[model samples]
Target: MRLFGYARVSTSQQSLDIQIRALREAGVKTNRIFTDKASGSSVDREGLELLRMKVEEGDVILVKKLDRLGRDTADMIQLIKEFDAQGIAVRFIDDGISTDGEMGKMVVTILSAVAEAERRRIFERTNEGRYEAKLNGVKFGRKRSIDRHNVLSLHQAGIGATEIARKLKIARSTVYKILEEMKVT
Candidate 1:
């Protein structure tokens, strides 16, 4: 049976070196390793799709961790079921879990639920923190580079949006947005 490795990271700034090294050490060939720099919540990963297409029956898929496969419990369980149906085995080296038998299946399910719960908790905490910040008068999003009053005055002075943008050292789109908001254009 062929051994294929999968690795993923949520962002471009995160390194894949540790997972790649572990896969290599586990006997997964360098060329057999597929990776993606994407969030585990996303299932539309190009690398993962390619790996799924390339794997055959009896082939084994190795992942560094269960969470590396996915954060959504249903999606992760569905993927494992698909692999199982195809006579393929998924092994998570870090978690010491595999879909090889009944016990393995149960363990995987429980762990998947826990992972999904943790993800939800993180999301709720983030939203709570943002709500608190907003209540404290903390402004979100990018700071305005140009004032709406200035743009309106310039527009009233017969300056076109393109000229106003150039004069104000801002994009024409920004000038247009300001004008649109004030209904001056």
Candidate 2:
């Protein structure tokens, strides 16, 4: 059976060196390793797609951590199920977790359930916090830099939208939007 490795980092700025080194230590050839520098939530990762296509029925997929495979527990379990259907096995180096038989599958399922629950709780907490902040007069997003009265006066004074934008250090689009809003009023 062939051994393949997949390494991933959530952000492009993050390094994949450590994971790649671990995979190499596990005996996977450099050519057999695929990597991505993108969010795990996205299924469109080129490295992951390539690894999926390259694995054979008896092939084993190696990862440095369980999170390298997916962003959420449901995604992880779904990926494992798809691999199991093809008779492929997955091994996590750091966690010492492997899926090869029924027992392994059961453990993965239990872990996935726990992870999913934890994710839901975190989401709920975040939303509740945001709601409370909103109730406390906390405004979100960037504050308006251009004054409406200044824009109106500039337009009335025969200053062009581009000139107003350059003088005020605001976007020409913002000048136009203000003018249009004034027109509507």
Candidate 3:
């Protein structure tokens, strides 16, 4: 059976070095490793799609952690079922779990539930923090790119959206939005 390794981080700001290192330490070749810098909730990740196409029957896919595969239990279970049907096995490095046997399948089901619960806890905590911040009168979202006065002044000066965007160092869409807000030409 061919061996493949997958690594993923939720954002570009996060590093894949740790996961890659772990995969390499497990004897997976660098060329056999696939990685994605995307949230687990996203289904259009290029790296993951490529890996799915590359895997074949009797292939073993290795991941450093279960979260690297996905966070939603239903999605994870569906993916595992697909792999199981294809005679493919998935092994989590840290969890010491593999989908090659009945016990492993049971553990996967339990762990998927735990991962889903953990994701819910994280979501709840984030919302709680946001609620607390709003109660404290902390403003969020991007500050105004330019004040309304400046936008009106620039619009009246015959500045087009492109020029206004360049001068204000903001997106052309933002310039148009500012103009639209003031109902000015």
Query: Can you give the TM-score per candidate against the true fold?
Result: 0.59, 0.64, 0.59
Instruction: Report the C-alpha lDDT of model 3 over 30-67, residue by residue, as the tens digit.
Output: 99899999888765678888888999998999999988
Q: Report lDDT (CA) for all predictions.
A: 0.89, 0.90, 0.85
Q: How many residue pairs clash in each candidate?
A: 0, 0, 0
Instruction: Please identify model 3 stretches exceeding 4 Å from their true place.
Output: 108-185
Q: Per-residue CA lDDT of candidate 2, range 10-128, in tens?
A: 99899999999999999999999999999888778899999989998999999999999988777778788788889999999999899888877886778778878988999999999
Q: What would the per-residue lDDT of candidate 1 be over residues 1-185, giving only the tens digit for each residue?
A: 99999999999999999999999999999999999999888788999999999999999999999889987776787788788888889999998888877876787677668767877998999999999999999999999767889889999999898999999999999988888888874
- In model 3, pairs of residues that clash are none
Candidate 1: segments with Cα more than 4 A from true spot: 108-185
Which candidate has the highest TM-score of all?
Answer: 2
Q: Candidates 2 and 3: which is better by lDDT?
A: 2
